[model samples]
Every structure is written in C-alpha cells, then in structure tokens.
Target: MKNVYLDNNATTMIAPEVIEAMLPFFKDLWGNPSSMHYFGGQTGKHISTAREKVAALIGAEPSEIVFTSCGTESNNMAIRGSVEATGSQTKVITSRVEHPAVLGPCQQLKNKGHALTEIGVNSSGQLNMADLRQELTGEPTMVSLMWANNETGVISPIDEIAALVKEFGGIMHTDAVQAVGKLRIDVKKTPVDLLSLSGHKLHAPKGIGALYVRKGTRLNPFLIGGHQEGGRRGGTENVPYIIGLGVACDLAAKNMDKEIKNVAKLRDKLENKLLATCPNTSVNGDRANRLPNTTNISFQFIEGEAILYHLSDIGIAASSGSACTSGALEPSHVIRAMGVPFTAAHGSIRFSLSRYNTTEEINYVIEKMPAIVKKLRAISPFV
Candidate 1:
C-alpha cells in the first residue's frame, strides 16, 4: 500500500532545502545571537539575513518582523500585547470561526473585564460584515481575525475588514498561519496592523513563527527578558529553526505561482471526483473563494472518525472535522459555526494538499475515497 498524506493544514513536511539551510547553524554557528563576540556576531548577521528573507516573503519591512516560538505565541503577543499597550480602549472584536490562537486570547481578555464581540458568519462561512460594521461603530481596542480558516479553507475578506478597522482606529491583527505560503500576502497592500504566521505551515520546522507589526503600532512585550526581536519578543532565538524558516519562506516565494495552479488543479480533481462518486456528499464553506489547495467535504449520515480509521488502514492519511475523544464525537466548531446540519457536521473531512503533492497521489485518493464513504454509510443509522 502506498502512503498518502493530505493533512497539510494540520502540518506540512519539512522541505529538504530548509533542513540543509539549518544544519550549519546547529554544528558550526552555535553562538548566541545576543552575544557581542566575533563568533556570536557572525551568527547575529545570519539572523539578520533570515529576518530579511522572512520579511520579504510578506512584503514587510525587516524592522517590523518579530520572531516568536510559533503561531500561538505570535497571536498571544499581538492580542495580549496590543490590549495591554492601548490603555483606555477595552473592546476587542473577532470572528466566530477564528483559530484557538486568536480566540483564546480574546476570551482571556474578556474574562479580565474587556468587552468582547464575536461576529458570526453566514451559512456559507463568510464573515457577516453587517455585524462587523455594527461592532466597529463603537471604538474597539483591537480586532483579531484569521486571514484564512484552517478547517474550511475559506479566505476572509481581510483587506476590506482591515480598512474598516483602520477607519475605526482599532489595532487590527490577522492569524495568517494558513494563508502565508498558500496565498499571496503583501502587508504593504493590506492595512492590517499585525499579522502572524507559522513556519511549519510552509515546510519549515515546527518551532518557528513570526509576527509582523506595522510601524508605529502600539504593542507591549509579550515575552520580556533579553532585548532580542527588538524588545517586542524577548528570549534566546532558536537559531537553527530560524534559519530553516527563512529558507522555507524563500522557497515558498519562488514556488508560489506554480503552487497556485498545480495544487488547485489536483485539489479540484480530487474534490470533484469524490463529490460525484460518493452519494449524499457536499462541499463545505465558500467554495468560490477558498485556498486553492484545500477541500472540506461532508459525507452525510456517517461518523468522520470511522472514515478516518478505514483510510488509515489503507495507508491513506486524512483528517476529520469532528473531534473524537474518549468515544465522544464533537463536531468541528468551524463547520457548526457555518450552520452545517448536525447530520453532515459529524461526517465532514478536510483534505489539504501542498506543493509536494502529486497528481498520482490525488488520483489514488479519489479512487479509494468513494468506496470508503459507501462502506461507512451502509452502517450509518442516520442514512
């Protein structure tokens, strides 16, 4: 049996080029970037170069980029930091479908006496701009939204939302972890005050991510110790992973155009075939505006975990929207937020592709998925 991994949104395989770029930092250039000695100074220069590379990937100035541990840290820094820095403004606005990273901080702030407004999405999983407009009527301290949803692959109208947030004078932040490599993101073009990205989503290692703080954005330090990351984030930098992230960003920039076409083609082929062959299947989210490499499909009347188990047995790796723990099934919050019927929500599966994925792999998945769905449906009482 061939191994097929289609869960790129959960995490991606590290690029070989990224590994190669990171090796020297671990063995030879092991000096701390914060040190003033010649050995450390050389390592510091490498860090600067990596900073430039990461900045270029998002069309941001090098000075605006602050390296952090991962997307979670970046998000916490943006939300927690901005709220603390802005003294009087207590209102924070966000969407119902944002990742835990963004939502967690917002909820935490709410517990600490800040006003929280969660804007809902339509049945199509598009943000309700009317609710957003209503929320923005009052002065909000911050607005944190995801650029693209992880489970649904629905791309938010961030440019428009950011403009609105700007007009309201609220500090805007976007969790761009899923959007950074798959989509073209130019902070210069978008007026978001802060954006967070995880390197692991783009074929870099898991321990690295960055936050872009637009010049003059008021933000308190999230992790304060050393003067690293220009006093925005403080700690000894993970040198090897930082180098790996830089290379990953460079590779992403070079291959982005090709990935936009090839990945989309393969994803569409897989999604179209599965929907056509499998009975009682529906595509989730706003299909017209989504990340090219993702498709979430719901096979009604069956448990998603059962389908995942069967796929695992066949050496085909996939993910379910339903969170199954201790034999209890909790449907995806994202799908539920989109108003997917209870029957379909329990059966939704997300298949996210990457640049490394091939047509053969996609075809193999398409051929096997229908039979798997059918087998599960036969035993499903809801059907």
Candidate 2:
C-alpha cells in the first residue's frame, strides 16, 4: 500500500536535498570543530557557514543562534538560562497549551523556588492574553508561548504577546518548532527575547536544532564544557545533521511563498470534506489564523485511537490527541485545557500536511477517511 503521511507536526521525512548536503560531513569532513588542528579547522569553516544559513533564515544574527540537540533542549536552555541570568526574579509565566518542551522545563523550575503562573486558553486554543496581562503585573517574569500550537495548529498572537511582556519589562520566549516552515518568521521584526526551532519539523534530519537569543540578552549556559556556540551550548556538534538543517532552512526560505498558498488550499479542502460528510464533527482550533498546513478535527461518537487505527490500516497516517498520550488515562492536556467538551476530547485527530504532500494524497485520504470513521463509529458504544 502507498502510505500517506499526514503527521508532519510530529515529524517529517528528510528531504533528498538535505540528506545530500549532510553526506559529506559524515564521511569526508569529520572533525572536531573545537580543535585548532588543520584537520579539525576545516570542519569549523563548514559549521560557520551553516550557522549563517540558519541565522539568515530566522532574521537573527549568526552570533545569536546557538546549536542544540533539538527543540526541547533549546527551550530548556532558553527558559532555564534566562531565569538563572536574571537572579532577581523567581517567577515564570507561560500558557496552558505550550508543547512539553517549553512547559516541562518551566515545571522543573518550581523545585528551585521559582513560581510558575499557568495561564488559560479559550475554546479556540488561543492563549488568553487578558489573563496573561493580569499575571505579568504581579512580578518580574519570563513568558513562553508557542508561536503555533502543535495539536490544534492554532497560531497564537505572539507579536502582540511579546509586546505586552515588553511593556511590563519581562522577557518573552516562543517555541516556533511547528511554525518555522509553515509560517514566515523574522526575529528582527518581532522583539521576542528568545525563540526555538527544530530541524526535523522542516524536512531536515532529527537531533539538530537552533535557539535564537536576541543580542544583549544574557543567558546562562545549559551544557557547560567547551566554547562551542560561543559558550552558549557546549559539547561536540552533530555536523551532518547541522548541515542538513542549514540546507533545509535555505529551501524553506526559497519555497515558502508558493507552498503556503498551495498547502493551505489542500488543508482546507481536506478539512471541509471531512466536516461535511461526517456527523457530530467540529474543528479544534480557531477557524482563522491557523498554520496553513494543519487541520485538527473531532468525531464525537468514537475514540481517537480507533479512528487512527482504522485510518492507518488504509495507509493514511494520522494522529489522535487521545492515543498519543497512551499508557495514561487522561486525554490530551491541550484539548482538555482548552475547555473542549469531554465527549469530544477523546475523538480529536490531528492531520498535519507538509510542502511535499500533494493534491493526490489529500484526495486519497479524503476517499478513505470517511469510511474509516463510519466503521469505527458503528462499533463504538458511545454512538
């Protein structure tokens, strides 16, 4: 069976171009960038060029971009580093719907005596900025909200939120892991203090990512050892993955304009078809201003896991918010925190598209998905 990959938000297939870019680093150019020897120094040149590429894509200075293992490390480094640098503050503020990368580290800060304020989101999954404003007034704090939500594809008003933090003299961070390739990001245009991105989400290989720290921001190091990343992060670099990420960034910058329109049209078409044919259905996020390539839907009468299994059997790759948190009884925290009805929470499915997805794939999934949902609903006692 020809598989259709609709789970781009979780991860993506590595692009051929990215893989080609990385191949040389693994075999031919293998050397420690920190070493001053001639063999190692050649690797430094390639790493520097890659850094500039990553920096250019995000509109940040090459000096400000620090290479890290993945988005989670970048987020942890940013949040922990900022609070440690600003010893005067013991409070952190973030939303209820951030990816675990952002929220998990902040939750850890509580053990160190840092107070955490968890703000709520509306049913549409947009952060409650008004509540955020109320929280910011109380103390010196750092605020982290994802640029786009992972489960629902809801694009938060990060520019406005960043400005609100500035008014209160607070540092702002945003996890742009899902938003990097799907949306246009210019860090210079937005004065956020920190932002995070992952390579795997953008057709690059996993195990490499970057953190953007605005100039003049003081950050404590996450991994302390060598002077790599200008002492921001330490340890040996993953040269092959970094090279792939650089090439991926270059490609994303090139094709972002046309791909955005094409994918958004396809995403909307798939979503509309499902909602029209399926009964008791609803979308999970704000209808307007979501990631152009993602659609999350809920089928009320059945569990999300059963729907996903049925779809998978037909070569359709999709994810259920409920099943992703398997081994645990609780439903998706994101959906639950948004105040979605408990009845619909177990039924949420996320279908994320990438630039590589074609019209044929969309049509194929649309042809197969309705019947799958029907089959699952028939057996579901909830129906």
Candidate 3:
C-alpha cells in the first residue's frame, strides 16, 4: 500500500539535509561541547554556529537561544522560570486552548497558590481579548500563550496579545512550536519576551528544541547544574541533534515561501475535496487565520479514532488530536475549549501537512476519505 503521512504536527520525517549535517557529529566529532580539550572545543564551535542558525530562523540574537530536550521542556522552562523570576505571587495567564505542556506548568503553579487565569477562546478558536485584558489588571503577570493551536492550526493574535501583556507590565511568552516553521516568525517585531520551538516540528530530529529569551527577560534557570546553555539550561549538549536542528532551521527559512504556496495549495485541495465529497462534514476553527499546512475537519456521527484506524489501514496517517494527548479516550481540550459540539468533537480529525507533501499524495487522501467517513457514519447510532 502507498504511504501518505499527514501527521506532520505530531512529528515530521527528518529532512535528508539534516541527517547529512548530523552524521559528522556522531561519527567523527563525538566530543563533549563543555570539555576544554581541542576536540571538544571544535564541537563547541559548531554548537555556537547551530545557535546562530536557530536564532536566525526566528529573527533572534544568537545569545538569546537556549537549547532544550523538546518543546515540552522549553514550555516548562519558560512558564516555570518566568514565574520563579517574578516571585511566587506572579499571576499566570494562558488560554484554554493551549497545548498540555503550557497548561501543565500553569496548573502546577495554580496548585501552589499562584493566581492562574485561563482566558477563553471563541467558537472559532480565537482568543477573547477582552477577557485577557480584564485578567491582566491585577498583580504582576506572566502570560503564556501558544502562537498557534496545534489541533486546528488556528493562529492566535500573538503580536496584539504580546503588546497588551507588555502594556500591563506583564511578561509575554509564546509556545511557537507549531507556528515557527509553518509561519513566518520575526521575534524582532513580535515583542514576545519568550518563545519556544521544537526542532522535530520543522523536519529536524526529535529530542531537540530551543527557547528564545529576549535580552532583558528575567527568567530563572529551569534545570540547575554545571554551566551549559550559558547557565540557563543544565546538562551536556546533544551535539548531533543540535546540529540537525540548526540545519533544519536554515532549510525552513529558505523554503518558507514554498510552504506558504505549494504546501498550502495541497492542503486546501485535500480539505476542499473531502468537504465536497462527504456529507455532514464541517471544517473546524477559523478558515482564514490559520497555519497554511493544517486543517481540522469534523465528520458528524463518527468517532475520530475510528477514522484514524481506517485511514491508517489504508497507509494514510492522520491524528485525532495532539500526539502528546493521544490515547486519552476523550475529545481534545482544544476542540472542547472552542465549544465544538459533542457530536462533532468526538469526530474531529487533524490533517497537518509539510513542505515534502505533494499534490498526488493530497489527491490520494481526497479520493479515500469520503468513503472512510461514510463507512464509519453508517454504523453510528447518531446517524
């Protein structure tokens, strides 16, 4: 059977160029970046170069980037560290539709007596700016919001939100893991004090990510140990994966136009065809303001897991929700937060694409999905 992987949001296939860039580190330059020896120093220099490449991808200064294990680590570090730096009394503000990584840390803070306010989202998954403005009123706040929704690909008004946070004398952090490679991000213009990104989201290998800390941002270290990541994050660097992340970032920067144009074209074709062919189907989230490579659709009276299983059987991979939240036997928090009805919520499926996707692959999915939805809906009691 032909393999059509539509689950780029969960994790992407590693880019061939990234693999080529990383091989040298594992084979020949296998030295600790923190070591004082010549071999180690050489490896350390490449790490610095990697830092520059990562920074450049988001229009940040190289000194501001700190490497981490993944997006989850970056989010935890940004949220917890900012709260620590501010004090125990810091008010944490976030959206209801955020990834678990952001919500998990905020929940922990709430349990510890810190004030935590979860801003609500509209039916379209747009943030309620008025609610956020009201919550920004009391105490010194640290607002952690995602740049885009992972499930629905709904882009948040980050620039406006960041400006509001700053106006209220609050620190602003964004989980840009999904938005970084898919959308054009320039930290120089966005005014976000902190931003997180995972390398695997952009075709780099897993186990690599970065947090962008603005020059004056007061963030305490999340992991404490011997000086590494400029004493911001502890432990020895994973040099090979770091090198791969850097190369991936560089390629993403170069190919962003193609992602917006070609990948988006393929995604639109797939979405449009499925909608045209199927009955009782509707697209989720805002149609206009979203990532170019993602679409979430809900097929009424059918379960998303069933759709995924059938699609998988056909070698066409998709997702019911965030990979981090998979297997929970419930609708996605993101979908539920947006008030997607129980009928459609259980049936929501996310099809996230990538630059590597082709028109032919999109056509294949388009051809197969209507029948899958129909077959499953035929058995549903709700039907």
Candidate 4:
C-alpha cells in the first residue's frame, strides 16, 4: 500500500539537513554548555550560533530567543511569565479558537481569580477587534493569540491585534507554531511583544522550541534552578535538537519562496478538485488568507472520523474535528468558535500539507478523496 502524509499541522518529518547538523553535537561536541572548561565553552559557542539561526528566522535579536522543550512550554512561559511578573489582576485577552497551549494557561489563570475574557470571532473564525478594544477597559494586561489556526489555517490579524494592544499599554503575544515556516515574521517590524514557535512544525526535530521575548519585557521564569538561557528558561538544553532547530530555520529562510508557491498551488489544486468532485463538500475559513499548505472541508451528511477512516484505508492521511481527538466534549473549538453548524462541524476534515509534498501525491489524494467520502457516507447513519 502506498502511504501519504497530509498531517503536517500535527507534526512535520525532520529534514535531512537538520538531522545531519545535530549528529556531530551528539558525539564529538557532547560537553555541557554551562561548564567553563574549554570543551564546554566551545559547546556554548555552538549554542550561540544556533540561537542566532533561530533569531534570524523571526527577525529578533539573538539575545531575545530562549530555547524550550516544545511549543507548549514556550506558550506557558509567555502567558504565565507575563502574569507572574506583572502581579496585576488585569485582564488576559485571547480568542476562542486558540490552541490548548494558550487556552490551558489562560484557564488556569482564570481559575486563580484573574480576569480572562475571550474575544469572539465571526463565522470565519477571525477575532472581532472592536470587541477586543471594548474589553480592554484600558487596564494593564497581556493578550495572547495564535498567528494561524492549526485546524483551519486561517491567519489572524496579529499586526492589527498588536496595534490594538499597544493602544492599551498591554503586551501582546502570538503563538506562531503554524505560521513560522509558511509566512514571514519580523518581530521588530511587526510590533508583537512575544511569539512562540515549535521545531517540529518546520522540519526540525521535536523536543525543541523557542520563545521570542522583546528586550525589557516583563517576564518571569517558568522554570527555576538553572542559569542556562540567561535564566529565561532553566535546565540544560536539548543541545542536539537545538542545533537541529537552527538548521531547520536556516533551511526555511533559504527555501521560503519555493515552498510558498509550490505548496500553496498543490493545496489549492487538491482543494478545488475535491470540492468540484464532492457534491456536498464545502470549504471552511477565508480562501484568500490562509497558510500555504492547509485546507479544511466539511462533507455534509457524513461523519468526519468515518470519512477519515475510509481515507486512511486508501493510504490518505487526514483528521476530523471531533471532540475525541481534541480533548473536549464538543467538536473542535475552532469550528465551534466560527459558529459552524453542529451538523457541519461533525463532518469537518483537515488536510495540511508541507513543502515536501509533491503534485503527484496531491493528485493521488484528490483521486481517492471523493470515493472515500462517498463510501463513508453510504454507511453513515447521518447520511
């Protein structure tokens, strides 16, 4: 059976260049970066170079980048650190469509008596900035939102949100895990105070991520007891994975244009053909503004997980918006946030692509998708 991978939003396969870049660090350069000995001092140099690579990817100073275990940790640090350092009961603003990394922290803060209000989005899963402005109340707070939604790939108005947050004297943060490789991000030029990214989202090995903290931002340590990362994040780093992430960043910068054009075209080809062939299928979110390699569709009168199973049998990878997969009782919070009909929400399917995906593979998915949905619908009681 031929296998296809269309779940890059979940996690991406590591690049060969990233793997090769980390191989030496695991063996010859195994010295701890914290030691003052010559061997260890040299290890710090490698770490610094990796920091520069990560920083360059997002247009931040090398000193502002702090390595972490994953995107979740980076997010937790950003939200919790800001709240802790400020020590104010000020409001924490976020959208209803945020990932668990951001929402989970916000929920915890809310439970602890902090005011956390979520701004609602429209039918297209975009934040209503006017609602956000009204909610601000001119109080000192931090607002966190993702740059692009993972399920729908809808790009948020971060620059606009940043400008709005700036008006209130509150800091702003963006979870850029899905947007980092697919879009250009310049922290300085964009005016976002903090941003989070995951290595696995951009061809780097898992277990390494970074948080971009602007200079003089009010941030407290998420983990204490180590002097590493200039005390921003504690404990010795995952040295090899850090190196891998740096290499991935460099590769992304080099190949961004080719990636955007090629992958976006492939995604569009598959998406349009799928809709044309499937009678009741409709796309979700704004067509004009989305990540280069993602498409969300709903097949009416069908269940998403069953459709996913049918596609899986034919070696097509996809995902459903069911609560079972999302750690919630309802359908995907994103689809729900968009106010999608419950009937349509149950049939939502996400197909996320990557630069490595080929036109032939996309065509293969399109060829198999209609029949798979049809087969699932036939057996589906809802249909």
Q: What tens digits encode model 2's per-residue C-alpha lDDT throughout 175-283?
A: 9999998889998888799999999999998898999999988889999988888888888988888888889998998899998999999999999999998889999
- lDDT by residue (150-191, candidate 3, tens digit) is 999999999999998998899999999999988899999999
Per-model tally of clashing residue pairs: 0, 0, 0, 0
TM-score, each model? 0.98, 0.97, 0.98, 0.98
The TM-score that candidate 1 achieves is: 0.98
Q: Which runs of model 1 end up more than 4 angstroms from their true locations?
A: 325-329
Over 4 Å off in model 2, which ranges?
323-325
List ranges where model 4 is wrong by over 4 Å: 324-328
Collision count of model 2 = 0
lDDT of 3 at 271: 89
TM-score attained by model 3: 0.98
**Candidate 1 residue 159 C-alpha distance from true site, Å:** 0.7
